[model samples]
Target: MTDANTTAFTNPSTFILLGIPGLEVAHVWISIPFCTMYVIAILGNFAILFIVKREPSLHGPMYYFLCMLAITDLVLSTSTLPKILAIFWFNSREIDFSACLTQMFFIHCFSEIESGIFAAMAFDRYVAICHPLRHSTILTNSLVMKIGLVILLRGSILILPCPLLARQWPYCRTNIIPHTQCENMYVVRLACADTRISSYYGLFVLYCRIGLDVSFIILSYIQILRAIFSLPTKDARLKTFGTCGSHICVILAFYIPTLFASLTSRFGHNLPRYFQVFISNVYLLVPPMLNPVIYGVRTKEIRNRLLRLFTHKGTKAFSSGVGPQTDLPGVAGW
Candidate 1:
């Protein structure tokens, strides 16, 4: 056999992203459903961004964090969805090495952006709950912008090295990425160069940057709960914690699946493929869907604003048909 022919057959250029083994045609079957989710996630988060932007009253730290969250959701879903659909619907599973690296860069960058924003949200919540009087001074717009700058700086710095590590590999034949998108670990695994450095860096950044970020969030909440309980009135205490409950729920949703994915990849990559995709989807889509809901429920003002958007003009007609109704401005806003 010719050398070129041997190399061609043995050295894979790309792998079909056969999702979830044992679920026959896992690639084709998951395409329609997952694509639907991608659309919903993008639209839902965009709606939140639109509502926040148009509503003058939502110009606060919580809303600011919500905006950041919406953007991150778009970033992550964009990173994963197109490649997945290509694999499933069109039988177009091949991705150029450079495209894979590019996807990997954005995926890690945006995931860290979400993490960093959650930490910032926790700090914002701490100030708002623990020191209500200083909430304005503590979470000023300038300060919030600075926090955004930090997220940009930190997320870029953390994820830049992984792609650089990807490029160091000689690509000596193995190009099949096991998953749909170019996840960091899979890219590193395909590298022909020694991947010890890449593996160490990936884990190190995971533990130090994300681990430290989660620590700060938990610490902020601990202090916030203490302050909430020390308040003299039950109503005051409830009101204080209520302000941050949405944020708390969001943080939990974002962190748990990400942490689980990290741990599973480290130890259980051989586990069921369905499990991996399930975790990935939950982590990516749940936050985008829940962020709006959490804010609507906890803030009250956002909920009422949304209600007003739909029903305020129709109120007269509704009263004539179903009886009379009145919405106090304050209650309506909340």
Candidate 2:
């Protein structure tokens, strides 16, 4: 778009993302680690998905949210990884303007979905802890499906405009982007027209998203803590803490890196490019890799069920002379 509000990039076809700012290092160095992490992240999240889908004993509102969370992680990992890996491995970071818009759209959509899923998980944990008597009543199949639909609606409506607005912008200026992926603000800053409106809208979008999701998470925990402290038995208190602890850890791990990147960039703009890239990458890779482990490995019940599911599957396959993963255990309560 032109500076005076003219739609400059109206017919733009392609744009280029400058690979990771500046670091004379070879692309392979970046590609290897980045691709490795993406692979690990995808596999880890998918394993959790597999476990949840196969283990019937783990079927419940909690695991249902976990399934959604895993799906979010998968989408989040996939959205940016391919481009990132391509830029790093092949030294080709240029993407079509439309492709950039598509990447931006999916990134925002999935990240927003991630937050929405976390908020849903928080509510699930809160209900299990706070309203044990009515947890099932409140978290029925219909209610969970309704929440899922709300998440889909919110994500699609909030993020669809990003690509639409971006694509409509005129791009007579340089098509150079400083990052591998067309991150919302990064790509937005490249518009020939003033991006004040886009920035405001971006903040509004985030405000609505982060504001709503984080508020629900905090409020859920607030009531959860009150209920836990009000309980009499030490065993009761520990059990309550144990149940919520995994979720708390996962939330902190997910949110803190993001907060660090945002605050650091805001206050430390002078930080080197690789440093910024590294810090930003942490938020992407860490959560996907750690989430399933935090929720499954550290939790006893899910771990036991996972082990049974896998071991039983292996035994059945070996007995049948098929293969290790020939048959999966059915989902809980299925």
| Pairs in clash, predicted candidate 1 | 300-334, 301-333, 301-334
Q: What is the C-alpha lDDT of each candidate?
A: 0.72, 0.73
Q: Candidate 1 residues 1-334, lDDT tens each?
A: 1332235333244434544435537667676678777777776677778878976666776677778878888888887787777767776767766777788898888888888998888887777666666777778888998999899889999999998887776666555556667788866776566889989999987885568999998899899889879888898777666566677787888888888877777778687766775676667656666666666666565665567667776556433444222221111111
For candidate 1, the 10 contiguous residues with the lowest summed lDDT are 325-334
The alpha-carbon deviation from the true structure for residue 161 of candidate 2, after best TM-score superposition, in angstroms, is: 1.6
* Model 1 spans > 4 angstroms off: 1-16, 21-24, 312-334
| Local accuracy of candidate 2 as per-residue lDDT tens digits, 1-55 | 1232333444456677666777637667777777777787787778778876765
